[model samples]
Each structure stands twice: as C-alpha cells, then as structure tokens.
Target chain A: MKPWWIVVRKEVLESLRDRRTLLSALVMAPLFGPLMFSFSMQTMLKRGLDEQDKPLQVAVMGKEHAPNLVHWLESQGLEDVPAPKDVASIPAAVRDAKPRLVLVIGPDYGKRFRAAKAAGVKVYVDSSDQDSQRDFRRLDQLLQNYSSQTSALRLAARGVDPGIAQPVMLDEIDVSTPASRAQSLLAILSYFLLFSTLIGGMYVAIDATAGERERGSLEPLVSLPVSREALVAGKFVATMAFSGVSLVLTLASFAISLRFVPLESIGMSANLGPKVLTGVFLSLLPFVPLAAALLTLVASFARSFREAQSWMTGALLVPTLPIMVAAMTGMKPTALLMAVPSLSQHFLIARLLRDEAVPLTDGLLSAGGSLLLTGVLLVFVVRLWRREKLLG
Target chain B: MIHVTGLAKRFGTVEAVRDVSFTAPDGRITGLLGPNGAGKSTTLRLLYGALTPDRGEARVDGLLAGPEHTEARRQLGVLPHGAGLYPHLTARENIRYFGELHGMSGATLEKRIDELVAMLELGEAANRKTQGFSQGQKVKVGIARALVHSPRNLILDEPTNGLDVMAIRSLREVLRGLRAAGHCILFSSHVMQEVAALCDDVVIIAGGRVIASGTPEQLREQAGTTTLEDAFVKLLGSETAEVQS
Candidate 1:
C-alpha cells in the first residue's frame, strides 16, 4: 500500500512535469469553452438584434427606366452603394460587400409600371450571407407592401369601399424560456464538451497506463514494493484529474458565455449566475470518473498506446450513443434518465441551461453511481496489476 | 531472497513461462540467461509480484506472488528495460517523484536525490529534462531512480540493452560495487560476456525451463567445459540446434 502511494504520487508529479499534458488539461481545454463560446454567442446575439429588419443596399445597373421604383425603395430606408453599369459589376459589388441587392432596371421599366403589368426586374442577390438574406427578404416585403398600398389607394381614389381594402393583419409571438432559447444553440456545444471529457480524457488515461506496459515498463513498476491497489488508484486519479479539469472548464465556459452573451437582444432574460453555473458544473462531475473508469478498463487490455487510443476512443464514443439519441428526439430529464452515463450529462445540462433546477436526486444518483463504477474499476485494475502480461 | 517452484504461465493456448524453479540467494548477483522468449523476463516479473503463476509459487522473503502483494517489494528496486523514464521530467524530478512513491518525505527525499545525483556523476544533467540526454546518460539516471528508495534488492532488465562500450563498463562497475555492498541483484541478459563477468551465480533457461544454474565455475565443471559460454551452449543446447516445431 505504501509503495503504491509512491506510484500514485509519481503519476501526479510526472503529469505535472509533462508540459504537453499539463497545458492541455489545465490551460487549453478549460479556456477553450469560455473563449469560443463567449465570442460566438455574443457575435450572433448582437447580429440577431442589431440587424433585424435592416435596410437593403441596392446597386443600380443598366437602363434608367422607372424612377418611381428607385423612389419607392429609398422610402423603404435603403441606402445604395453606387455600382458600375457592367453586368459583371453586380457579382463584384456583392463580393466586396458594396451592395447586398443589385437591381437592374430595364429600359422598359416605366412602361411596365404604367401598364400595371407583372413585368419582371432582374434582381441579383448575395444568398449565402445570412445578413444579406435578412435585408433581401425585408426589401422584398417592402416592395410587395408598396405595390399593395398603391393598389389600395388607387381603389380608394375610385371611391370604392375603403374598409374593403384590407380586412386582416398578421403578427407573431414566441413564448420560450431564456434557457430553452439558449439550449437551442448550445446543445451542439454540449455534445462537444461531452466528447472532450469522455473521449479525450479516455486517450490520456489509457495511454498513461497501457502505454507503459506495452513499452515493457510494467515489470519495473511491479518489481518495486508498491501495492497493486494503490497503483490502480494512482492511475485512476491521474486520469480523473485530467477529466475533472476539462469538465469544469467546459461548464464554466457555457456558464460564463450565457451570463455575458446579452440574451436580452434575443428577448431571453435567463442569467447563468453562480448557482446555475455551479449546478451545471456539478451535473458534469459524475461523468468524469465514470469516463475515466471505462477508458481504464479498455486500456488495461490494450497492447500499445495506439491500441489503447483506438480501443478507448471506441469505448469513449459510447457517450455518442446517448448524444445521437438525445439529438434524434429530445429527452426529458427524468431521475432514471439523468442517472444513466453519457446521456444524463447532456440531458441534464440541456435542462440546466433552460434554468430548470437540476433535481437533487439526479445529481446525487449520477455522482453516486459513477463513484460506485469507479470502485468497480479500481478493483478490476488492481486485479489487472497481478496479471503477468500487463505487469511485465 | 526469492524462491520459485514449478512456476508456469499460459496465455490462452501458448505457454509463455513453463514449469521452472530456482532460488536466488541474498547478497549475490544472480544472472537469468535466456534467448529473447525463453521466459527469463517472465521469471523476473514473478519475483517482483507483477505476474501470478497459474501453478506453483514464487516467494520473496516469504511473500507469495499475488495481486496486491507489496510487503516484500518495499525493499525492492527495479531498472526496467529501456530505463522507463518519462521523457518529460528532469532527472532530479524523476528521482524525487519515484522516491515519493516509495513514501520518502521532505528532507529524506531531498537528501536521497542529492546522494544519487552525486554518486551517478549526474550533477550537470540532473536539472535537464530527460528528453535531451544521450543513451548512457539516461541509463545512469535510471540507475539513480532504482536506487533512490534504497531497496535491499535491485532488478535490472537488459541493463545494457543499448549502450556504448563506456556506458556498459560503467554499468558493470556499478553492479560490481552494489554486489560488494551485499545488495541482492538480479538481471536478465543474452550477452555471455556480461553475465560471465558480473554474476556470482548463473541460471540458464531455454524453452521455458531452467537447464543449468550454478556458480560460473560450477556450471563450467558440470558441462566439462572451461568457458561459461561453452557451458551455456552445451546445457541450453547447440547454437545451431534446430527445433522442428
């Protein structure tokens, strides 16, 4: 037992001493979520709010016909960026972000409006840019509104029933919690966090132990006066340390991002404060040890680092089963569902982001069960220490 | 210090180490000589409690080779094949880290580290990360790590696996000095000259069985040959001897 403690202490020291693993565990992954999430979420939210119903910038090209059409769009709030008359200039202007909408008025455009005809105007648009699309759609709606408003006025001028010009109007309302709104986008991010904790740490864990054996270092380790049980614990803790750090970082990232993402822009009022973020971090805690244990089992039998990496990767990918299922059909955060490995973290995190209190039972059950599984793994690893092939 | 009786290990259908037996006296250098797959490494693993035999028993200071076995291992030190140093750690850090694993603390661990560094002539490289060191330097660091905890028994597996002549000579000198100080030393090797020069007793194994084990002179006498190499060939069979299977 004493000697095994030495092995465990050594595992930690070596891990800390290794610049690559240290950087990945303590610095890289932890900051990854905060950095990427905050940047993306803030940008998206700002764009969604600031750019809503924005005016389209149209470039005029070829044949000045309907001065009324140009006057109609200016009234709709479009400020045009002057464009060259060449047809090729349409693509070039859109590419340079000079104009989002390029309208080529034909020589017969005045004849078309006077005839009250559905004569077409060639309009080229940049379809790929979401902002450009929003502006384009608004411009389309404004044009249609202008034509309708003119028709109604014309009918009124004829002394028809003004009341009969329009009988109906349409408005829309969205009723969803701030958490649910955030969950809509963050569910994808959650899947990635789950993978890093489970799959990424699985690689680190298996490689630490099984890699040593395949390299034939296990014999020296065994030949020392280290207890088998302590050796298992040492390896287990080292792996879980890597996982725990990642879990904390991933949750902290979401928590910080949500709190600071300015959800009011999207009409969401949810706040990811100390309590909520803490709950989220707590929710992910159980998965850390469970993931480590599963990977440890796979690594113990692996013949080399590559073999362990592949096998543990396959094993860690087991989380994706629940991820795929959750993605296919949303899961309700039930006590039973939340207690199951892989799925539970994602399911509960989705709820947590929606500002739903993670049920105490779910957190306890998941943490308790994972810790129990860790015990089972520790037992197995200890037994593995006595195996000749693995030890030597 | 270590006893083996009819030990055997089977991996599914293939038996890696078969029924074999030997005794290692305390305060003596015991050489385990065999071909690459002849189970010499396996035998060493049994003594370290790394492997559990499917049959018979291997005991170190009366401790059976089993899962969780550690009582006898406390007085044991090991320098595995290739040194097994984590490449990222400095030499001083590596020694302190393993020493801590053996429960050496604060002042004691520091003192031990200093002594090992000084003894191994590694003052200059002690602070350098192992990644940049030459093979001989790494091997010396490995020896320092094994001796850090001051175990009564030391096991070196292919201690000279890849070394220049100077490094090998240095290693031989270290082993000889440790032997002189009454430390139980066990090493596995395929080199005849190394074992003949450093070992006080030799155990020659072939086909997973111990064919001859005695003092070098005794083994030579048993084979009616003057040289240890000649005696090994006679006992383990001719170098040109062919196996049908």
Candidate 2:
C-alpha cells in the first residue's frame, strides 16, 4: 500500500468510530438545513397571509370634522374606534392595540376642508413594525382616493374637464419569473451548503493533526520513514472523503425536504429534481477539497485539538461571509461572480434553482479558481508538516 | 552503526547540543548517560532525522540524517520521548500503523507483528485498545511498535523511566536480546544502574557535550570510584548528578 493510503485508512477507521464526527457529517448537518428552511418559510408565509386576512382597525379623532371621509373608509372595511381624549397618546395607543393603526385629525381639519386646502391629518403607527404594514398601506390608499375624487368634483364645478387636468399615466410592469421571484425565499440554501462543505471535514482534519500532537504520538508519526508529503497527502485525502460525504448528504437532505414545502403558494417552485441536484452537487465539489485542505493547514499549525477547534470556529466565517454579503445587498449574479469560491457556488446554485442553464466557462472558472487556491493551501500545510516544531 | 559527528543544535538563545560526537558500533549496546536537560533527547532526535543539527551531521549506516534522509531512516527504529500509543487503536493496530509507514505490509507485516507480540508477551492486550493500558503495558506497546519494522539500528529515549522494577528488568532483557541480534542499539538515560547493567559502552554527557565514553569498568577506573554512580558524579565534577533509581 502507498504510505499516504495507510494514513488515510487509519484515519477513516477511527473517524467512523467517533460518534461526534458521524453525528455532524451524517445526521445533524444534513437534517438541520432542510428543517430550518421548511419551518422559517412556513412561518413567514403564514404571517403574510394572516396579515392580509385580518380586518383593518383604525382609531379616528375629531370624527365630526371628517365624518364623510370616515364613512367612506368604513365602507371599505375600516373598523373605526373613537380616538382617546389626549391626542398625544396616539402612538402609545397604537402600540397597545398591537397591529391596529391610529388616525389623528387636527382642530383645523374643518377649516382646511372648507377652504379647499390639504387637511391636517397624522397617521400613528410604527412603520418598521411588520404587522402594521398592510393597515398602513390601506389607510394611505383611502386618503388618496378621497383627494382624487374631491379634485374631480371641484374641476367639474369650474366647467373644466377632469380628463384635461390629467397628463401621461404611469404603468407598472414586473418581468420577474416565478423561479426568479423565489430566489429571495431560498437564498439560505447557499449558506447551509457552504457551511457543510467547510465544516464537514473539520473533525477528522483536526483529529489527524492537532489531536495526534496532543496525544503525544505525532513525534513517532513524523519520524517515520515516510516522506512528509505522503503523510500530509494521506491526511488530506481522508479529510476530503468525510467532507465530500457530508456535503452531498446535506445537499440531498435539503433537496428532499424542499419538495414538501408549499412553495407554489408563494409563486415559487423548489422542485429539486435529479438534474438540478446533480448540477448543484458538481458545482459544490470544488469547495469540498478546498475546505479540506484549508482546514488541515489551520489545524496542523495548532498544538492541540482544543486550540485547533478554536481556530476552526473562527475560520468558518471565511466561506460564509461572501454569501451573506451578497444576500444582504440583494446583488444580482454576474459572470464575474463565478470566479470567486463561495460566492460563485452561490450564484451557480441560484441559477440552477432558477432552471437556467449555466455557461460552461462559469463552471470552469469556479472549479479552477477554487482548486488553485486549494493547491496553495496544500503546499503550505505540507511545509508546516515538514517543520520540526510540528510535533507541538 | 550510528555516528553523530560534531552535532550542535539551538533553540532561540539556548543551545541544546553543542559539539557532541559519538558512535554506537554494530552489535553493541551503547548508553547515552546525562543529567536532566543535558541534550540527550535532542541528540537522539538529530540521529533519527526528527531534528536538524545547526552544525555537523548524524550519519545512520553511512548516510547523513535529516528530513531528507529517507534511506537512512528506513533502517532505524526509534522510540521517541513521550510517544504515546493511540488510545482508540488496539495494540496490534498501533504496531501495524507504524509498520505500514515503514513499507511493511501483508504477510510480512503480520508475521513481524506476531513475533514482536510474542516476544513482548503482550498476549491479551494485543487485541485490546490501548486506552486501559497500564504504564508498563504502554511502554511495552511502544517498544513493540519500534521493533515491528526490524530496523538495523534502534534508538530509544528514557525507555525505562516510568516502568516498575519488573517491567524495567524485562525491558533490559529485551534490549539485551536486540543487542545480541547484531542491531546497533543506542538509548539515553539518567539512571546509572540501568546504564551500567545494559550498556556495553557508556558515553557521559554534561552541558550538551560528551565528557566521557568507555566501557563501564573503564569509566569507573578513570573516575577512581568503585560504584558507577559515584564515578558518574566524579567525572561530571558536580554534586547534582542525583542518580535516579
């Protein structure tokens, strides 16, 4: 047997017996991503649906000044309540009612209406509050209707045509496909994928390097007749095995669970058929070897398993950061983005999920760039293993 | 034969081994005797290519030893200081892992493993994992791994330090057997009696330099003392010898 194969065999044999590593690679990592996706999407959709179904409750102050407008609002399903005596307490009253909005009318409301001027009215609700958003939009539309109707009546009284007052009308057109629209809801898939690829091989990588040192066996192991390259190569191969298995398993679980979600209701389809799964899995392959090599390098420099774990925990953010940044900014996927590691995988998976055929160059750039970086990291780790201080 | 010529090593500002030279000829048991922190482990490490000497070279079987000395290292079996057996692997697996690293595999490896296991008498624990091993059992496991490859030379550091009397006696017998088999064996120790009983020639090291080297009786005659312990103290000219049991 090749020297490195011996090392890999031993590592795999031991890691298979380790319950913690198995739990993370086979069970926890695969299960968590899909379950989290289903629960969060279900909750968000339920909240939006419930918000639209609820009655819009509004508190009207100085009702006599705007009785006609209030009657119009009531006819449109606005359940109005008498405003509290102290107008200053309107914001607090809105908070107490929870999701109910407050509408305040000033004393000059009657005068402003008679003079054919803008009415002094204030709407009290937290704009940042998610549940109050639908009620806020309803109130704004109601006031706008009242203003447009009054303007038309006044224009007719002056013997001028209301149509003459109108200019070019603006039309809104959305060109988003159902799959593209679902991208926002399914953005989290890339994060979990990146996480699995980065963290899947971490346990064995640390155990084979830092864990060996802590156990005091590294001295004898390094002193063996085998070249340092073969030893490191063996370890890298073993780590990649675990990492590959974990990445595939997690993605499979995520793809399977996505099918059960009621994505169609939200104008989205998560049909992770075999074709898309195969594409996603292939695009993500480059990251597994890269993650394995990078993790081994970091763990090799550490003196103990505990120390390696600390460094690994911090290092995990490197792969996760790009996806997070792209998600937060809602950045559109560009051809250039396919040249980066984690970011490129995110874009490729996004395109595949959207049922778009990815260009061959994009796939090559993503895989090639990641492999080049991994080569650099592998050389660094091999050099570290060759050092005498590696026994620490 | 293992020949270390003018070997010197330093870590930062502190010199571990300075101008140290020695030779353990074929079929002889040579002892490297030193006080605590006297560079014995560093010298052994340099001989086996675990460390690079800042000056000079350690040649194992005529080839200079260092990280690039794979040919020379293949002929050497080393029991490094504080090398622990893998707790998750059985005694046999631990031995086989190192044997495989040295290019021993299949029937050859299995045959060698059997011989070492029987020679060390590691019967029941041979199949059991090393987690529950006693101190003596652990040392025997280390010895078994070191010998599994059947190297031409053997280097062990403080092999009997933590063993009980019975274990030490058995270890001494094992070393004697290896020496009789024509393997060049060099081991380091702080205990005078252990060296006096096991070594054919004793090399006394103090402050990272060789202060004396000769047969046990010759060393005693040169120091003008009857006991090897008193002779070691006299040769070093220090009251801090503090010979271990």
Candidate with top TM-score is: 2
Q: For residues A328-387, what per-residue lDDT tens digits would candidate 1 score against the true structure?
A: 786666777666676777776777778876667877876776677777876787666656
lDDT of 2 at A268: 76
lDDT of 1 by residue, B30-85 (tens): 99998789888777766666666788888766777654577767767878778877
lDDT of 2 by residue, A1-392 (tens): 89999999999988887888777777777787778878888788877777666667888877887888888888878887667667667677677664267787777898888888878788888766766766789889988888888888988998988877677666889887888878767767877887877677989999899998999888888678889899899999999999899888898888778777778887878858899889999999999989999899999989988999999998888888888788789877676677778899888988888889898999999998789889999999988988888964
Q: What share of the true interface contacts does each candidate keep?
A: 0.65, 0.77
Chain B TM-scores across candidates: 0.94, 0.95
State the displacement of the C-alpha of residue A362, model 2, in Å, after optimal TM-score superposition: 1.0
Instruction: Give model 1's TM-score versus the native structure.
Output: 0.77
Rounded to one decimal, what is candidate 1's iRMSD? 2.9
Error of 1 at A384 (Å): 5.6
